[model samples]
Target: MKKKTTADIIENNKISDGIYSLRLKTELSNGILPGQFIGVYTENSSRILPRPISICEADEDKKELRVVYRVSGKGTGDIAAMKAGDKVHILGILGNGYDLECLKDKKNIVIMAGGIGIPPMLGLAKEIAKEFGGDNDKQISAVLGYRNSDTFLMKEFEKYCKVYVATDDGSLGYSGNVIDAMREHKLTPDIIFACGPLPMLRGVKSCAQVADIPAYISLEERMACGVGACLGCVCKTVKKDAHSNVNNARICTDGPVFLAAEVDI
Candidate 1:
């Protein structure tokens, strides 16, 4: 269930040039899962709608929810200006998160994320590490992509899984896209999970299909209402719904996470 509440900003740190990590103290963190998001209200009263930002980390014991976001517009710009001790209205722990249960039987799992899509994968990696334990045979490989060497969360991700990185410029890891890094490393995972731009997701889907491996993808979309009411964030689906008889799905509610083959992308 989603709740409308005011959350106190405990930490607001800049991660890169235009990126920031905002941590909030709230009771809503209890049930938040990897791949879920929070809708943050902007300070600008003119912009009534809240911006949907993906949850980067959730600490249930600490009652803290962290989100990493870029300043792309007025709403996010307002968010970027917020300081510690500030209070903001948020609605969340929303959306259906990644399906971790399905990956349990698979020994080798790959997590591929691009740009800002990299944050949520951290929580997923942590959960997987905790669930499988040190003696388990499961191996997690995380392939992350960035525009340049100025990146965040690399160290955090490294603590949980085997991390590989790719940058458009040769300043960092492999001097190409994540696909190139995966190829160069010869990574062969039994299942794949990805969250990135459309091109990256499409590439991952294609790769999974060729490899005959199951895959899940988290999508990014512009949303008006974070819930399903507004119908602003719908995507084309591969099949018609049994009830609606339409080949459309809501990105905000029906997913932000879906089987790679289920959506048109």
Candidate 2:
């Protein structure tokens, strides 16, 4: 039942190849947590649906929201054209974010992310670090993946967590994927949080199951309606949904983030 609002664009600049950093000033930052996303309505009338992008950071005090996204197609291309001082219509504070309940009584944590899925983890780590209250005993490590040496947000994450990188071309930290980097690093954690492509998430789920570590993951589904009403982004679940009596869940509402064991992956 949320209404769309026009927000002022503070900055819109390309940070890396095919990627952009968009900053917006809006009070809708309230109720938005790490792992939640917003739907940005593009200027083109032909592209009616708003493009949903995971929030990179949200500052309640500044009333600012940071979104880092890839210029994937025409819709996103339109978004890239937007500039500072422009007005954009966005609807959100959407999706149930990463559940912090699984973090209680846990100390060591590992965050796994690949490609554009890496943005949400930055916000997640920031919150985790805050919740830990500067307790140095708590170690938060980020295992990230990239196609090559051109990595984004490396400095921001390095500020909060120990960063390890994996590149497909052997152009960076680890030569293989995130899973290989994790094994090589021999990371032992009490809990995990991940966001990435399906294959990458499947790997993380398997790792969590075999190690008996609690893990939560966000599904990067291509969505039409950013709300559950569309049913365009349902994912398979282990249990039947109470409303539909089917073993499925809408990624938009039920979660873009869920316990590793809760969904089939």
Candidate 3:
């Protein structure tokens, strides 16, 4: 992890009323992998510490990272207030990214992402397409779900592979949740990558467990320090060792990325 000044804010536009995407200039974004996030300081004062926001998009060529966030709380509201030239501090390219090595030579890859969970999947899809010879032999499908069509990021995924959208309000391709869309699509995937609410992730885990397909999931939890020290985002895993029999691993450090079955979810 590294501390860096936010050199520029390219875009602070609203994706929706409560959700906004910020494209900021920062060299810390370079070499970032999928599933890694940045800890951004919402306020200049030390009163409010940095908040972890997932790295939604990164332009290595431009040395910038983009984060999409919802105005659900005060810190985020302040971040939403940021302008094109505002300076901010960030610690980033942190946490364990998805195991890209796992996708090597896979013939079929399927991604199930809901809500903001689709962020990493966007990166994953691009990696998969590029890794497997441009999505020709390796088929890629994204079962993207949102509250409504406007919230879906299918347009981003469409450039990489086929996309199926499922919205609860019946404003998209399929009426129902993402799992329903997955079932309806009847995808026979070699591997599944997913991120979403716990219930949704749990459902994905249970489904993958039964289907005997390997899956990787990105988890969301509150954090104090974006690094390991805080012990704030502890996730219970079955793995146990002598010193730490509790298996209460730090999400900010140990993960943010875990095998589907390893996490309690």
Report lDDT per candidate.
0.90, 0.90, 0.81
Q: Which runs in model 2 stand beyond 4 Å of their true positions?
A: none
Residue by residue across 164-261, what tens digits does model 3's lDDT show?
99998998789998888988988888888898888889989988899888888888778887777767788888776234568777787778888887
TM-score of each prediction:
0.97, 0.97, 0.93
Clash counts per candidate, in order, are 0, 0, 0
Better of 1 and 3 by lDDT: 1
Superposed Cα RMSD, model 1? 1.2
Score residue 227 of candidate 2 by CA lDDT: 81
lDDT of 1 by residue, 1-265 (tens): 8878999999889989899999999989997779999899987889998899999999989999999998888999999999999999998867999877997689988999999899999989988887874846888889999999998899999989999999999789999899879989999989998998899999999999899888899998789998888778988898775446799888888899999888998
Task: Give the Å error, residue 152, model 2.
Answer: 0.5
Q: Please write out the lDDT profile of model 2 over residues 1-265, one tens digit for every residue.
A: 4568999999999989999999999978876789999999998999999998999999999999999999999989999999999999999878889877677788889999999999999999888888874887788899999999999998899888899999999999999999889989999977989999999999999999999988899998889888878789988899787667899998988889988788987
**Model 3 TM-score, all chains together:** 0.93
Q: Each model's RMSD to truth, in Å? A: 1.2, 1.1, 1.8
Candidate 3 displacement at residue 167 in angstroms: 0.5
